[model samples]
Target: MVVEIVQDKEIWDRFIDESPYGLIFHKWEFLKIVEKYSGYTLYPCGVFRGDILIGVFPLYYKRNMAFKAIFSPPPQSGIPYLGFVMSSEYNGLKQDKKEVFLNQVVDEINDYIELASPNYVSISTVSNFIDIRPFKWNNFEVVPNYNYVIHLDEDLDSIWNGFKKNLRKQLSRPEILDLRLVPSEDMSLFYNLAKQRYEEQGLTYPIYSIEYLEDLFRVYPNHLRLYYLYYGDDLLGSITTQEYKRYILWMGNTRIPDNIFGNEYIIWHLIQKAKEEGYLNFEITGANKKNLCQFKTKFNPTLEICYNVCRKDTLGKLAETTYQKFVRKAG
Candidate 1:
């Protein structure tokens, strides 16, 4: 088997769209959207046995000043949370034959990474493929990226049974609550509302700007949607949902009216829309924030961990070791 690094989109489009294994991240259209918005160089590395494309690892190059490597370039997001995406569906389908696929994928990707020559390589949000032992790293950190999902194969009633009792009730409530979910391209309004809510509560605004968001929205089109909540013409809440590959990621939401507006209700509404749009799952994104975790639990979705794998420069390795040694000595 031989691996090839396909930089052209036309070739990748055909492969992803045609592959029986169904690789999502390796799809050319997806890569184009990401590269257009994030400006990350998309490397579509795949393994071919004779004439057939067998396995692929979709990777991007980035750098960070904090982790200077043994060899180097300018810094980037390392493994930007969203970049190292793989097709979970594909991985699941090929699980039994994964060893062969895994070896081919890594061999190709390792070569691709070396050409980029990043001293550090990081990957995250890996799904079931980790069981195949996907990648080996010098240092790694693992943490839960809790996601909420509802089985759409059944009727809404059956799906409701899967949600938390309170959540189901909230979704079914018809108390004439003056809430409205407006779907629109006016993402500026959503950003302003979210920013105000964040500042009012003394929370730092995210690194993303309205322009950046608009750029992202334009690139992904229906793949990512924006919705704002209103109460009798008063903007109450806002949410950004991204339908990446198979998962509908409820990326960010904010309630201007705070607890009085029922943030949970807003989320349930989003999940229902995701269901209506035929999404298989809803990702609540990551965990670590105590308050965030508490809020995520209300939906009653299965919880799973998201890991960060890190590689250190000589200096970073020494510092990390020293820090650990110091903590151990203190203990």
Candidate 2:
């Protein structure tokens, strides 16, 4: 088996397309956009046996005066999870064979990491790719992240029936009927609203530029949808949904305060849209944020836990500890 940097888009994306654990974020174009916007150098590696590609992972190299590290899917990229994408053929492998193949992949990755010699490395894998034992064996600290996903295979009525009473009441409100979901190309509005939300939460604004979002919309128009809720001329809220295998309620921002419940209404509309499109699942991305998790829980979605593997060398670990202390003090 040999591992090398994969420069061919056809080869890289073909494996991702064939893998059930693959995501739209793993696409070559998406990585290119991420690199361009985040100013991170992308290192995409492919593990091959004989002449066949078996596994692929993309790392982003981030450097600053305070730190130098590599991330599978870097911070503030709006990517939920991305790690190794193995070939679908591996899915049919026997348990023992699967373990062997995974170890080989991890060995190759370790080799790459040694050559790069970054201060730290972090990798977050999708929920379906549960075999992270290889990473754990390599001394990486594995942490779990959770997401809320509603299986859409059931009838719409059954799905709606699962919602909490208050959520159902909000969806049935007469005022909700007045709001129209308008699909628009105006990403600047979405960015501004998202920035406002971050500020309201006392957090830093996201690093994504408006140009980057426009590029994403241009590249994957069908996969990315931006909708604004409007009551005639008054804009109430905005949400972005992505259709990549499953429907994801990617990001949302609302001008309406918590008292108004505009977000719940918009999410309900998106859920109905997902059902109409025959999507297998509708995911409300992060189920870890306190208030956000409470809001999503009202929909009665299943909780899916994903894993993030993190590792840092001695000095890197010290630096991380100091950084955390500084952040706590600043907060």
Candidate 3:
């Protein structure tokens, strides 16, 4: 098998869409947007066996004089995960065959990484990507991340019954249940609200700007959306949901001290809506945040584990530590 950088958008996107392990963040257009906004070059690499494709990896590269870095999904892109994903056929292979196929793919990826020789490297894989052994074998530090995913196969009553009592009590109100999480192309509003929330919490904003979001929404209308709830003319809350095989609560809905039920109502509504639309799962992204976990746990979704693989040389380690210790604080 050979690893080659894929230039055709259609071919690259088709593979990602077909893979059960692929995510919206792995799509070609999404990567292009991130590349444009983050000022990093994106390399959509595919592992091919004969004439067939077996694996896909969306990698980002950046250089600053002698220092360089590589990332999948890159940092501060508001993307939870983006690493290599195998083709659908791999999922059907026997256990031994799966290991062999994965080994070959990782070998090629490692070769490419060696050729690039970045000072630092990071790759965060999707929750379903459980076989990260190849990366571990290559001496990449493995870190586990968490997410909450609700299997939509269960009945509405059964799913609701699983929720924490406090969450259920908040959503049980007739007024809250009757309110709708309306979808719209209001990019400015979503960005402003999200940006303000981040500032209020003393955290840096995630996405680049409204233009970045607007482009994504326009390009992938079917995949991403902005949904908001209203109390008369006042905007109670808003959320961005990502739709593919799984309906994901992608972003927004930061706590509004006054509108306590806004987020819970939206989440419950999305769960029922996703199930009704025949989606297999509903993922509440970023379950690692301690403060956010309190809200996410109330829904009682299954805790899912993902992995982040990283490697840095001595110089890279020193630079990162220095930045964390002094430069970041100085800024």
Most TM-score-accurate candidate: 3
lDDT, candidate 1, 156-260, per-residue tens = 666667667766666566632767778889987777876666677555444346776676667667676787777777766676665654454554555454434
> Cα deviation in Å at residue 264, candidate 2?
2.0
Q: How many residue pairs clash in all the candidates, one count each? A: 4, 0, 0
Ordering by lDDT = 3, 2, 1
> Which candidate tops lDDT?
3
Estimate the overall C-alpha local distance difference test score of candidate 2. 0.84
The C-alpha lDDT values of all candidates are 0.55, 0.84, 0.86
User: What digit string (tens of lDDT, one per residue) describes model 2 on residues 168-235?
Assistant: 88878777777789999989999988877777766666556778888988898988889999876799
Model 3, span 1-331: residue lDDT tens: 9999999989988898898888888888889999999889998999999889899999999998998899997776888888998899999999999999999999899899889889999899988678899998998999999999999888999999999997888887666755667889988888888877777765657677789889989999988988888755567778898898899888775554444577788888889889999998999988788997988899998998899999999878987797666543422
Model 3, stretches more than 4 Å misplaced? 174-178, 322-331
Ranking by TM-score: 3, 2, 1
TM-score of every model?
0.73, 0.91, 0.93
